[model samples]
Target: MKHKVILVVLDGLNDGVARHAMGHLQAYAAAGRAALYTLTCELPALSRPLYECILTGVAPIDSGIVHNNVSRLSHQRSVFHYAREAGLSTAAAAYHWVSELYNRSPFVISRDRHTEAPDFPIQYGHFYWNDHYPDSHLFADAEHLRVKHSPDFLLVHPMNIDDAGHKHGLDSAQYRNSARSADILLADYLQGWLDAGYQVLVTADHGMNNDRSHNGLLEEERQVPLFVLGDAFSFNPDVEPRQTELCGTVCALLGVAHDKPVCRDLLRPAV
Candidate 1:
């Protein structure tokens, strides 16, 4: 049977300390229903490039989206691309950078903020412009999209953790609290998504350092958490998945054919 997918990317959430802060996610990971892994982010550990990386399953060096400032519509086919091609609906309640990558370049808020164009890669989109946009609100927006569109592939990205990391160092209470707050927010909606038959993938693009910056080789900046919650995943994974494999994995769960590489080790035999 084909499964629907909801990919929730908590931008810039790290592997070590922040992991402890996300109580709801950790509980889900421990309950035996979800498979957890530590994903190694691609080089240049920046947001925009890694966003493209996670959605396109292509490395920065190869995609030429190596820098965050390189703003334009993606040239590579993404998970949304393949899902739409297979006659599946796709939607996103994410940051504007996502809109810039998939919907249009140099995002114009008036025209692109609340989009419902069937032809776009992200067919139904609700994009936020500022990093300060509340994670709680983003999740609500995602829920709205889910109820209204019932999209086959949904991308729900929240930026509060990353915004806090940039404003304060990773060691600060602010950063930790931001993660904790996100955990509380997830507690309100995750089970509903899963109960509704949406296989969930919660992960991060990259991590933040104590120095309050990324785009470096520090372990803290390179490693992030990946949690796959659904029957589609192997309950106990034996291999670490790369960030680039996300697109393919989502495609695989949605039964959409794609040319990208998937993290097959994480998948169950029936999937």
Candidate 2:
């Protein structure tokens, strides 16, 4: 059973930023198969719910996770849950959302030393340390978790760019610079993951514009990229033309079946 998946959710990342940082996502898209989808995210385009949706097969309406820190704790049966149910060593680190909300998740390289604490859960201030710091405690944790746990399902998140984009408009030089910085780090990590022959899934909750605003109703805000690399998945080489139908495309990439009950505006299978 060589089942393994890693989802990297680049928060507040827009199509423009993704294209600009093509050097980061391009290789994966070019050398392998990739798609883009127009998927709506939670209000304010925050990280919590979007990342949650990526984990659980449910939408905001179904997952009961609409706001940051609100109903996240209830999102217990995540993909990790499924993986663990299937008896795979599931693990997630870096993002407190991943470490805490999915407490039953198999492994975590978290600072949440109280993992053994009965009341332990994901805490934002402690996880992010607030104030948009440049340091990457999460990135380091991801590396540690991968090496130590070798989890079958891993989720890694880096937040400085999203933090900066939220503070300064997504189009601000500060945001793009932070985005590039993220790309640099991502390139190094992604390359190594591929070298190790691990299947990697790269995507975002939704697309954002420079003003750090999301239309949710428009393609500009909803359309985000998806890149699946390595030997674990398969997709058509003409994946580029199917970029906007992201939601279903991703399901296909990961071998999951899609069932959109409420978010009817979500992506559909490409014709």
Q: Of the candidates shown, which would achieve the greatest TM-score relative to the real structure? A: 1
**Candidate 1 C-alpha lDDT tens digits along 63-93:** 9999988999888999989999999999999
**Native RMSD of candidate 1 (Å):** 0.9
Instruction: Write down the TM-score for model 2.
Output: 0.73
**Cα lDDT of all candidates, in order?**
0.91, 0.55
Single out the weakest 10-residue window by summed lDDT for candidate 1: 17-26
RMSD of every candidate to native, in Å, equals: 0.9, 6.0
Q: Candidate 1's C-alpha lDDT?
A: 0.91
Model 2 has an lDDT value of 0.55
Q: Write the per-residue lDDT of candidate 2 for residues 57-122, one digit (tens) a residue.
A: 555665566766563355435554454444555445444555646663433445453232322332
Once superposed on the true structure, which residue ranges of model 2 sit more than 4 Å away at CA?
32-44, 69-72, 104-135, 213-218, 237-271
Question: Model 1: clashing residue pairs?
Answer: none
In angstroms, the error of model 1 at 210 is: 1.5
